[model samples]
Target: MYEVVLVDDDVIVTQFLKRYIPWEEHGFKVVASFQDSHSALEYLLENTYDVLVTDIGMPKLNGIELIEQLKKSKSNSYHIILSCHDEFRYAQQAFKLEVFDYILKETMEETNIIALLGRLKEKLDQEQFTRNQHLKVTKFLERNNMTLKSKFIEKLMKEQNITKDGWWKEQEELLKLNFSDKYFTPILCFIDRYQEAINHYENETSLQFSINNLLEEIFTAKDQQDVQIFFTQGKFLILLPMKYNTREKTKHQIEAILKELHETIYAGFEVSITSVIGELNVKEQSLLESMRILLKNKEQRFYYKYNSIQNFYPISYTRDSIFQDYVEISQTIKELILKDKKDQILECISQQLKQIREKKYSPDSIKDWAIKLIIDIKLSLHALNHFERQSVVITIADQVIQYVETFEHLEYVLADICEKFLEQIRSTNLTTRNEDILKAQKFVQTHIGAKISLKDVAAHLHLNSSYFSRMYKKETGEGFVEYVTKTKMTKAIELLEHSTKSIEQIAFELGFENKSYFSKTFKKYFGMTPGDYKYKTKEKMN
Candidate 1:
């Protein structure tokens, strides 16, 4: 029920109203009655009353003055004024203070007061319902607009040409987007460790909404005229208008803006972002090309650490040699799988990844290679009668492709697949007695990028270190340390021979502390330093 407060300087008037009015029946309760306006103002300050009734002419703190004070405090109380005279000044002041109604005390009766209160209650109810409906409609439109905008951006990114310019214009107008400028610069902001953000929020939509709101606030502060579109995979595209005279100057300005954006996001959400700025392109036709280049540049993010800002450069396609490398790696992995050498298969995959990284292959190329390798492995297993049909394998392969984001995640997935494949092979009467040793070997190979110790591997296998070490040497004809060192050195050699990575980078990639130690270890193993080996390999290739 709506609350009502009655205030009048005369005690008789307040008492008569309180005793005679059927407030509850009219959907209101006279919560408080006061003899003076001072006490009523104090009560109003402490509480909220929806309807206020008071005498217009009082000694101090009159109805006008009380409402003026309440208005200063931003009160939303509907007010009714009672006066003994039909004074124009009093009615004008009451209307100015937005009083609900003015009643002359000489003609006011119980029926007239009750009718006024009933009409006020109906007005209040109608206003509240209208407000709630308006809020829901606003929220729905916001969600629908975002979805439509994202779709339009996705289409613009994919299609080479926008065939219906008028439709595009209509869409922009409908969405209230300002993209009429001739030149636009596309920027891709990628949230680093996106999966961690997803896990933190436990909802992808919530995370994306938060990021979008933050971006909008930052852009609005900077007075940037841009359109932000979000991808489902934690990437945001911002198409900013080209406003500066020179491209370099525009780039610098965008970098400054992005730096502020990065700092704000990190400070607020504790999430780091990497932004790649693409070259400027014309609005309608060249937009798709610029988007392609922007996405291609986004792949270079793997080359740098997180929380970086980089500019896009056109990528020169030289895929013949890369395709050849992929073929060779595919054949090697197939052979390793056929032999049921899980450790070697993982090592081969790791080396192939290193090669791809060193060659600066695009992210799509790397993903393609990974998908093809999984497909080849699945087909090989089917051919060997390990699986009766391809449906299950195909489903698993699709899941792996969908879920694998980082190289570490892919490594684990592929290792699990190899383990399952090995189990299937063993089901065909080919079982090894030294399964524990094999487990240790696989662990060491898969974790070759990390600093793995004998204790770590032994604990992984749930075996004693001393016994596992002896068993490993007996089975592999090499001690635990020797095998790990051999595996790392073999990978190092492959990198030095086939990749363009520097010796220092190779050393770090192989978990060596320094290049000097890596060089000494390489000389001891290959009878030459890594530099000499790399030079010799290059010379032989030439």
Candidate 2:
């Protein structure tokens, strides 16, 4: 927009332009006009305007002197002179000064002013476009935050409390986002296998476009109406209203849609989406309190971690001492996950909740605390994959949480969680025992060229043959003879399928005493000789 500053030391003229002119319609801003040239020059030094309407004669500083001073200062003022007299000296001097097309103050015409402003409008338009482009570039750079990428990760970890499950509660209480009970549900969506998803787009600009396109596809999906998506940082925030009767049903529907879009439409990660509904009966005072919780709650994130659709009645989960119990349980469970104390994590959760109940804490409190415990573990699992990926004991502990509803449910996980943690913490030869088994497996694997026997292996490890055999069986669930024979035959199959090694050569390489014995073991394991197994596998592949 073009802005004009008039200098006449005439209040009447300034007032006339301010009130009568349709400056806004003409794409102009008449910010302020000076009553004297001294003040006008000072204002010019401090501010900028597209045009200046100055009379040739004024008070302490006349128009001609001001114009001379303005030009002497090398100012970029597109001056428009307003003179009462049409004098030769003034016109000659103004022409030399490059004063843009002078005007007469004796009778100021609307046509001249309007035409001048129209020309100024073109310049302003170009300036605005350039400014907008600059702003967009700035935003893009800020979003990338080259050096601060780690900062983003740190903040997000802190926000979600990679340790605590109630980080959402803190966020909800802190952000003060009141939705006016608008039928809104918060969505927690993230890229699945993020590292591999954008492998094709190695360039920064290209990768950004790919990520952005994926986001666009989410909104355009068939069932994505009534969904408002935002990204607080890297993680997507989805707001989809509950469209089904029960929370469970709605969760299933949301998961299905997110899964189909991610799995079918894209070859990469699903860009997982989750939805948590607001408490329908929460007091308005608690509106802000529940805002972040309802949005980022375990209910929403659970779908991402569990890969299951679960309806969490966050509204129903809130109770008296239960709230406090949930908070404490969540804290303790988080402490376990970080310390890598897998077993006690479960025992700690169950025992703490039990104590709350014994202390006359409401059953509702136990339930809420239990829910918090589940949520805590879920968030940690997001960091540390499944417990089976970690261990069977952890897997069992997790299994109990899902099915925990009665005393039997509580008992199901107790022994496993408590026993494992106790065993791990109390033991000192943990690494040595693990290393021994691993060393045995490695020795057997690498020594296939020689006639390696259990007695030979025991002698190498400086252990008695009987105890060594038993330890091997206990560790691998197979007797030494059986395990060695199985390993040799398995390696024989690989060689048969992918190598040109003859039967005799393969038997010798696998430490088999003879080809006939190798063939026997191979047949027992594969129900076929090495030759027949290779042929069948090749046929199946074809």
Candidate 3:
């Protein structure tokens, strides 16, 4: 809808126009009205309106003077004049000032005014459509230009050699770059905490667009042809030309710009950036080399503190592999899981991730280690009969490595995996303990003829001794050692009653060391030694 403002000395006329114009039906809105032209001009100066309707004969300032002032300031409002027959000359002056139309107050009618507004709405609508089309075309061209530049830069980076004379000149002209023989410094940027940043946006494309807009605005503000920026392959490349004669001075210039860029991006968007600033005096022919060097050093971002801009340094990697202690680490994790040490499990994962970060291993090597570790953990669960293999979990384990862009992110992924694994272990451990207890009872009965130990029972169950001890005591109302002792005593009684085995022989068969210890234990449970019980039973039978 087009906004309309009215200015007329006649209060009645202004009120009537505002109240009964049916402006919405005609695609117009009367936003403000003033009985004096001066007040209307003041409002117009601060706000934008599409149409102005004012009376020519007013007090402090007339409609003609108001239009004249607005014209001087290049306001784009369409002006309509309100005049009586005595003010015909004023209307003439309004036409000279390029007003849209004139209305005589003596002959003005509601229908005529509404019809006029309809035409004005048509004109405004057409102009707005044209402006929108032009804007679309401009954006399309800009996007195409940026795409071409990005492709050209990518091609240069891929080719083994980049010559100054061959395809360089053609691309320079075609892409409208001025780096023929100029000295430039290259800078590369990686979005830190990219996973978090991506989640903050609607999608990846929106995030890219926002960053591009911010970069363009900042670089374009410098208004220098020497500065160029490109977004390609999940990174930003900035080419800063050597404007100063000395490298030190150029360095200072680059520093100032980077400081601004980093601070603004982080402050405005809550997004941290890691930048690698290159040499200040790289020639056009060495541009790709400088860029490649910067790109290679981008791996340094894996260890970079968030929101930092650092000068170029040689890339380094630790010679030792993270998998050297895989056996020890994996075993420790399994023990902790069975022990139900949740905090220790997470801390253990954190420690390994910290080591990997400190070593600054190649990204691929780190990811490989992470994948192997997680998969081995799942396999350990399966071996313990605590986990059933799920294709979904395996798929996650395989694809998770690709998303490990930083040490922090990698740690988060590994930590989440550990937590979920702990959940599975906890849930399954409850049911597993019931089955394990039953199996343990059966094993003890089968092995009751010999001496049974808690350690032996735990080993049979493939569980840690201390963990098994606690679980056995909790599941049953007796300690494992106590249970073993009771089982032996009960068997001794059965032998005494059912068979004519000698006391010494029965003691020996029940895994007792001798008759004295057997008798002592038997007296404690039945209030008599084995000989007394046997004699009493025989007396009762006779």
| Candidates in descending lDDT order | 3, 1, 2
**How good is model 3 by TM-score?**
0.76
lDDT for each candidate structure: 0.74, 0.57, 0.77
Q: Which of the predicted structures, 1 or 3, would earn the higher lDDT when compared with the native?
A: 3
lDDT of 3: 0.77
Candidate 3 residue-wise lDDT at 84: 84
Per-residue error (Å), model 1, residue 110 = 14
Candidate 3 wrong stretches, greater than 4 Å: 85-88, 195-205, 245-249, 337-340, 384-386, 389-394, 426-455, 458-542
> Which pairs clash in model 3?
none
TM-score of every candidate: 0.52, 0.31, 0.76
Task: Judging by TM-score against the true structure, name the best candidate.
Answer: 3
Which 10-residue window of candidate 3 scores lowest in summed lDDT?
383-392
Q: Model 1, stretches more than 4 Å misplaced? A: 1-62, 66-92, 101-125, 177-182, 193-210, 225-233, 265-272, 281-284, 296-304, 314-356, 359-542
lDDT of 1 by residue, 1-542 (tens): 99999989988889889999898998999889887888888999889889889987888788889889888885577989888969798899989988899999897789999999889999989988998999879767766776787787777767666765787878878878765555777788888777878899888777776777787777777676465565646788877776646777887878887898899999989988888887665575566577767764555555545788878766553464455554347546755765678889878877777776677766566666667667756654553322433233444665565555455556666677767766665555312535665556556555556787899888887788888888777766678888788877866865675566789988887888999988999899989989988888879978
Stretch of 10 with least lDDT, candidate 2: 383-392
Cα lDDT of model 3 by residue, 1-542, tens digit: 78899999899999999888899888888899998777788889888899999888787787888889989885577999888855557666877988888988887899989889888888888989999999889877777777878888888878867677768888888878887677889998888767668889967656766787787788778785567777775678989876557867777788888889889888878887878888777776677788877776666677666677788888678777566656456657756765668889889988987877777778788887788778766754553322464333444876876766677778788778877876765555436677787567656655556777888888989999999989988877678777777767766765675565799988887788888998998998889999999998779867
For residue 157, what is the lDDT in candidate 1?
Answer: 64
